[model samples]
Target: CSNKSGNKILYLHFDSLIIFHSITTISKVSVTAGKSVSIPCLYDSRYMNYVKYLCEGYYWNYCNYVVKTNKPDRSGKYSISDDKNQKIFTVTINQLTNKNTDYWCVVEINGGSDHGESFQLSVSSGKNSGGMKWCRLGRNCVTKSSGSIDGTTVTIHTTELNVFTVTMSGLKPEDSGWYWYIQIPVHLTVTEKLINSKYCKRS
Candidate 1:
């Protein structure tokens, strides 16, 4: 899972206790709507025996667990496993859809607050899983290399099981096209609406 391109970014600071450090995870994980993904959560070597779980929710403060390493078979769509040797646990979710986007990797700290790191699991709906490409002025185009996207400052990352994140910044009218897993296209008529979710509002 660590062997990905420059698209993923690690969060140095998380919303937890001063002593409770969260696990290391991919900055952005992208996957197809129907594809499956295994999310890796790295923890402190001292807490190898601590319980690990995968939770899902729009709000980080009230995340609902989908699976745990202690109870792997409790959920049919989700399961978790821990490897003390690696000091990391993996959470696997099958048959993913748009609803299976936001998630958190949590560790139950002893006699203190729990540690966790949030991730954005963007489940895109695309049939073409090719490398990124860029088009200028809806004309000439070029094949893009990883971590070298043009205009939109795009970053595409992939881990074991094809999970990735398509993060695009600096949107422009000309920066429109089908750029592999992550695409940014301009719409003729744009109608904006205020989102009620905190995540969306922050975005």
Candidate 2:
């Protein structure tokens, strides 16, 4: 994962009972439809040799298997790979749709608790609409050149949530507003009607 913000490592904790088990990962992840996303699941060093997999679904009881490290890419859309050296395994999903909105990173353990962490996969609505901008300020984004913002990506921090980042390729001319860290919501207006043309006759 590229750290545009260079924040500290984020640790995800379970409930008080399982607080001992901590998983390192990003708080939130965002991807565009028809695009692919690579999510890094940093596990404890102890799980270096364990089998890793990505499960898909909103609920833990129904999280169906998408891909496993032991299994190669049979579907050509989902894949898993382990980097034992870094104690990290990555899950990549391609051709994501709105349905592909939730997933979990799982590690298999025989006759014991299988460690896992959940995350939300937001399919950007503006990604297809052509307004894209990366969140460089962590929780606050301000642009004064333009009075309004068009396309801005919002990512929820589900884990440690100390630092969250959303990346997009393009920036719109009008996407200038403040992304307040707190209760302030975004205010953007699409301006397809603002086009100026001299072809029409005056009434």
Candidate 3:
């Protein structure tokens, strides 16, 4: 969870069962800006009795970096609450930013090495405000393209060209991904329809 490398191993032992700690459950992996979200995590049933020993390490402002201990405080704009004895840890973050942040839960077995699990908090906004705006070359087109929607929108700017607006409306569960684009324009003046979606891209 904390380590994006995903190369680490965590093990726990309880009641001579040699229980290895693992993440049993998780909540939504991503969320929208200014929206409330929860991260639910659980441990292996064998280690349920020791659930009280679990603690959460939340990345308050950066990517996968823990900024505070397990307690509600003003130190950062976030809160952590859960029933450790029930093996349920819920981390509620407040006022997410454009930056990426992640959270992890760890438990150190008494007199044993610590084992942990983590989840990512995907933060997004209704509409991506920064990106290339496009339109087609035409006069009869609605002639509107200055606002933002939660989903994709296309506009005609030139009679021979096409325009597009990208957005993520009504935020859904399957909209998570890193989108890419490659363009090769055709006819100098053509009747065409364009569609676009807001997304994160890697160069």
Two-way lDDT contest, 1 vs 3, winner? 1
Q: Which has the higher TM-score value, candidate number 2 or candidate number 3?
A: 2
What's the CA error at residue 159 for candidate 3, in Å? 34
lDDT agreement of model 3 with the native: 0.41
Q: Ten consecutive residues with minimal summed lDDT in candidate 2?
A: 129-138
lDDT of 2: 0.59
- 91-148 in candidate 1: lDDT tens per residue? 7889988888788888875555566777777778875354554333223444443343
Give the runs in model 2 whose Cα sits over 4 Å from its true position: 1-20, 128-203
How many angstroms is residue 59 displaced in model 1 relative to the true structure, after the best TM-score fit? 2.0
Scored by Cα lDDT, where does model 1 land?
0.61
Ranking by lDDT: 1, 2, 3
lDDT of 2 by residue, 1-203 (tens): 11112333334456632232535544455667788877777788878889988888876566788888988679799988887865768788899888888887888776555667777776875432212333221233423212222445444332343343433224563443223322122323333347668997768
| lDDT value, residue 119 of candidate 2 | 70
Inter-residue clash pairs, candidate 1:
9-27, 29-164, 30-164, 30-165
Runs in model 3 with CA error above 4 Å?
A: 1-21, 45-71, 84-86, 127-203
Supply candidate 2's per-residue lDDT for 76.
93
